[model samples]
Target: MHNSHIFDKTVLREYDIRGVINQTLNQNDAYVLGQLLGLIVLDKHGTKVCVGFDGRESSPFLCEKLSDGFTSVGIDVINIGCVPTPLLYFSSFFFNADAGVVVTGSHNPSKYNGFKISLNNKPFFGEDIKNLGIISKNYSYVKKSGNKIYKNISNEYIQRILKDFNGNKKLRVVWDPANGSGGKIISDLVKFLPGEHYVINSDIDGTFPNHHPDPTKNENLKQIIIEIQEKKADFGFAFDGDGDRLVVVDSNGNALLGDQLLLILAESVLEDHPGGTIIADVKSSQILFDKIQILGGIPIMYKTGHSNIKKKIHETGAVLAGEMSGHVFFADKYYGFDDAIYAATRFLSIFSSKTQNLTEIISRLPKVFNTPEIRFFCNDSEKFEVISNIRSRLISSEYKVNDIDGLRVTTPSGWWLLRASNTEPALVARCEADTLEHLNQMVSILSYELSLNNIKLPISF
Candidate 1:
């Protein structure tokens, strides 16, 4: 009663289905996934679905095959070709589609590609995604073919993103899309927004000619930093590959960490929606949580991953949520989905009435020495176990720990987090303290713990 087609295990990740082009993933796999998704939608009594793809060379072909499977399953496919993942998500909400999917690699390397999906206006991931693969292995199709329609929501989407523009300061700024999918929309976004805007690497080049699109990494933000300072702009915004995440660089070219960005945005968001819950991933600094409470808003620490944060935001009615990796979701005046372009606009709106610039706002926050998220190689099979053992031992050692997503240990110096990455086979850790010496002391503790577990320390850290 069912047909089974096995897919590469590695491609079905905790967040989304991703893999190297033509290796772990291929056109046939896309078709199978597309068909599986269509079947699931129909079973849920859904008819229409929105589909989009990024700028990768393989995207066009993948999108075509994926659509074919959907159409064959009698699911009306509204194809919004070549857009950022956020825009795809927006389409689901804007057009009120029952489901949606975007073929994208996100911030991964050029060779990588993946799909981000939404069902019934919420993130469809984790077990939902794995279940799709499982059903794919046993699915039997019915003879039905749905119609395909082409729609371009680019202009409408950009207008919606800028509709609530509260910016009046007309500050000078630089925006870098890193030659990723956000380029097209960013180019149009600046045109209508109130600002003296400048942009670099805004071409939708999948090869990522300038640098990898992940602004969290310093190397990716280098060119934008150089341009902003050289042009004497007020600030800079760098977008990740699919444009959902944003990295802000001050006028002096110092990029604000993700928590700092959220902290800054939270202050403003709380002004209108006071006492609103603000969610930050466990990797965020303690200062962010403390500051959120001081600002009269509830601070919730949750697991990492955009989908996880989005789900938590929906469940708790949070006004805002952000991760250390630059994913910021706002529910105040917009959908509770991460959008770098919208976040950028909101960040700039803060400048509308303020005399002080970007850096000045951050200058007031208490300073802490912290390490950027440091990841070490661990076999996928063992990474989760490693974190579990670390958590058990830490608790047995009488150390206070928060096990929301992973084991976050509290120390007199500061706090340290050890979590298995949901997206990769690695354990991610971050440490922070009032001073550099204390910070290293925390690192030493982390190293000692890893050594005790027989995991060799990564020399780079």
Candidate 2:
């Protein structure tokens, strides 16, 4: 029975089950996941589920099969139609559903698609997702039957944001949805907001003809920055393939890294909840930690992945949390799921009472030189081993090291990080310091350490 299906054990990843369509994942795979997840949800939460999908080419077919599988197992499926991942997360709480699933490829290539799941308002990830494979193989059941309800959740989601923020200040904001699922919602959202909005690539196109929907890469954001400059806008925002992550640009068209944006949002959130816990992934700069401390908020550095950070945030009851990859989660005034559109709205709200622009606020922060993420490819089997070897070497060294996610060594001038990429067969490294010279020195040390471990340095900048 298993061999007859297209589900590959390799495709069922740690965080979300993703793979190349037709080859590794097909209608049967989606149906199996739907059946397994539905049964799992019923066993754990005893309630219905909310299902949504992004503008991926494969999403519609997967959603249909998954819905069929859910109904086959006597589970109620609230189909929210095509929406961003965050909108589905919003429906989970807004409708009081048991769980939710977002069919999205995220920032991956167009050929891939996957599921990001939430159960009982918490992330269903890591081993939870992996164990679904076992459940699918072992569980014995006949397809009983259930029901699927179609609902339009956009208006309610829009109203929630509008109600939370009521600002009369007018500003010029440029939005680039990159033709993802967020494209459908951004127009309506900007319509209600007080802004002179210039939207580019806001039409839902799964092919993403203009550019890949990932905003993390500078190339993907070029058009948005150009539009921002051409229009002389106040600021700009870009959403990822699924619209869970956000990238921002200043009025001058300077791309704001996620760490910098996190600092800006953290300050605003900490105003209402003094000394509240704020979580940032280990990939964030040490400057962010120092600033958070200076702001009178507790800054805790945790593991990278969105699922890991969200779980830690729940455990610590943090008011806000974010990753350097632009996944910003707010527990202060909204659901904790990372929502680019929601974050963009909240960021604009920060300018309501101030004449200071985003660039000005960013300039006020202490400047620190940092390296963009550098990735070096490694075999999947060798990736963890390389990190483990590096960790062991750092343990006996004079440099202070943090092994939270992988290894972060602190020097007098700055810090350097080397971690295994969760989604790919690559080792991710970054360095930062008070000076460019110091940053270069840290990078050199990292290079020496990796060499000692016999790992080849592929690219250096």
Candidate 3:
């Protein structure tokens, strides 16, 4: 193929391709990506590719160009229309396609868009993503007539999700999709669930006018918490823009962090699979890992990215895994991919099976003080060097450090972490301890470490 197209370097992320719409990404880039992906599939002796997009305004046009590129290469395209990222993943299996792609920006602002790719049911990321850039500049293209088929798998996806429901009691539940792509499907799904359901922001609005689509932020979760309180519901579930992340709120209108939610899911999963392996990201609270060990399951702390956790789960044969950023994966009965809708269903099933409420179950866990992920400004060029400096100093001082993804130092009272953000010009930090005073001490220690490198902690404990 003589169609020489170059992608902006910033768009080629570690896990997926993402960029500001029109500024750094456009129709031509999407078209070229489809062509390259189609070529890769054919090279692997595959014939069909599944394509889906989110509710972003730019998605449909990009999806159109992407599908054209796929068909131009003699690779049949199974278009799943506008749906969540998980549904795109499900389509790959349902249609027995060789490759899958989704046009989504995930939890980012509306002005951004990107693609997530998969080959043969495994995540196509890291070096796989970097290779696309090289291949786009130079590659032989196949010219043939391949077909594009439009299929709506909403009914099938909803049916499969509900099939896992084995609850013994009916409960009032609230769902907040935050006007994301999952709104339409979740609205349809609640109709079949056995409960009094309340769905807010059910419209699929690309603007995300209600609030940011990220459920991890407390400000974004306020609406759902309010809805839960007003409706007097058992609990509420909030999903990110592409429906790949989840946040749960108890009846008391208190939001649960991702690690806390993961512990809840782990209890049910370990009950079914004794001594199973459960993976949590490095940034997750140590309490979560300890709880998993106490539940008679093996806990493995891995990297922070969703793709990293997913890869680790595949390698370790783990049944469940999650990150602190609300990306939860369940491979016990379903595919091992992050799906907020499926996670919500599983949580509901678990909740309805027990007599204890979410608060009660969570209250049984050991108490600890921790800080939210704190990201401070640091030049992208210098962030890694700063981390390296800190790590070297910590190691020289005989600090117990885990450098899997970044530097996680084991303190006497608890632990503290310092890592560079993968997608931004910043450094991330967190500290945890058994008491408020210990937590403050940990924060001071982290601050002192940063100060050694001419940096200061943005917030005080």
Candidate 4:
């Protein structure tokens, strides 16, 4: 361990360990991470660990070394092989493992790679991840394990989803895995899905030779939309790099935002479990909260991180929860981790139900014009201060401001939110109104406020 490079604090983020390969994280980092994580699991709980990785080129190499480190620590390792983050999460419960770790860069660029970890089915994040950094600095050797096992979890996970619905109707689905880990498992999973699936960019390429894997951006879904229209498919689905999040397009190639999809899923879940707790992050529209209330469900607004959202869900025992960024969690019929594949399956199930088409379902919701997430570049240290200044200004004004995560100020016409992104060095702003002019007006007001504080508005409407 003396030759191993020290772990950087920047790479040990609040939610996960992520960094550029070779630059911040490499094989030695992976090995040390494995040892510390294995020790954490063994010391805190027991030795059963489930491991999976994404389609990144460095993922396999890291997974191999990480497994060796875990085995060296006297822990039993279950290698679920290359799969999505959600698949790894699902395997955690399916295999009854004590902990799990998914090697993925998530929606980051091809050069990035990281781990999303869990202990006893809960997110091992924040101080937990930071604690690993502390352990790494001390760097003590652990006794070698004579007990290590490699088991396959695909069959169990696949069976759980398949058992939900029999192959009844053939659905024409245009799926773009975006050269992600989902590409490797989606084809096989859909084989029993009773659907004529037309998959594009399904090859697992770490270079991302097609397009970026983030489905939230409209530009990334352009190819999938075109394929859906050309193939006359019922709908098209796109997954982020690790497949924990999803973006949907209808039969006519209309893109459906995550909140819209949540509305649809909420309706279905509320039907089965009325008055159940439904949670959404602050980034989501007020329309979701209103809809949840009207449908006899309790709506709880929470913070904006996936791990934060999951922890809230477990604490409140919320049956369903979602984020505007396409991360949807369902505790109603499945485990509560965000799963894009399972969400797509649920969407398909709804499409085949007695309800209306996706377009029709969306049309039934109240119309509100909303700006997509507007990110403005800012120094990480100064971003929070900028938000604080804006908050102080809003407090003196004649607007109702909610400072749950950032600043969500409400007016008669609409609402505007200004918050710092947890993952990136940018301030995220969004405005929504019943009319386009009102939305624009809100944006202008936000810009003026930022300008007054000597903080240049980094985004334009």
lDDT, candidate 3, 200-309, per-residue tens:
99899989999999988889988998889889999999999999999999999888888999999999999999999999988999989988999999999998998888
| lDDT against the true structure, each candidate | 0.89, 0.86, 0.92, 0.85
Candidate 4 Cα RMSD after full superposition onto the native fold (Å): 2.0
Candidate 2 per-residue lDDT over residues 272-298, each given as its tens digit: 999999999888999888889999999
| Candidate 4, 315-374: lDDT as tens digits | 999999999999999999899999988888887877765435666766678989998888
Q: Assess candidate 4 and give its lDDT.
A: 0.85
TM per candidate comes to 0.97, 0.97, 0.98, 0.95
Model 4 residue runs over 4 Å out of place are 1-5, 166-169
**Which is the winner by lDDT between candidate 1 and candidate 3?**
3
In angstroms, the error of model 4 at 123 is 0.8
**Sort by lDDT, top down from the best:** 3, 1, 2, 4
lDDT of 1 by residue, 1-461 (tens): 35688889889988889999989999998888888988889989999999999999999889989999898888999999999988999999877888999999988898999898899989998999888777877779886889899999999898887786775788888999988899989998898877689988888999998898889988787898889988889999999999999999998889899999999999999999999999999999999999999999999999989999999988999999999889999999899999998899888888877999877887988989998888888988999888888877888675679999888998877988898888778888888988999998888888889988899766576
- Which is the winner by TM-score between candidate 3 and candidate 4? 3
The Cα error of candidate 1 at residue 22, in Å, is 1.4
Rank the candidate models, highest TM-score first.
3, 1, 2, 4
- Of candidate 1, the 10-residue stretch with the lowest lDDT total is 391-400
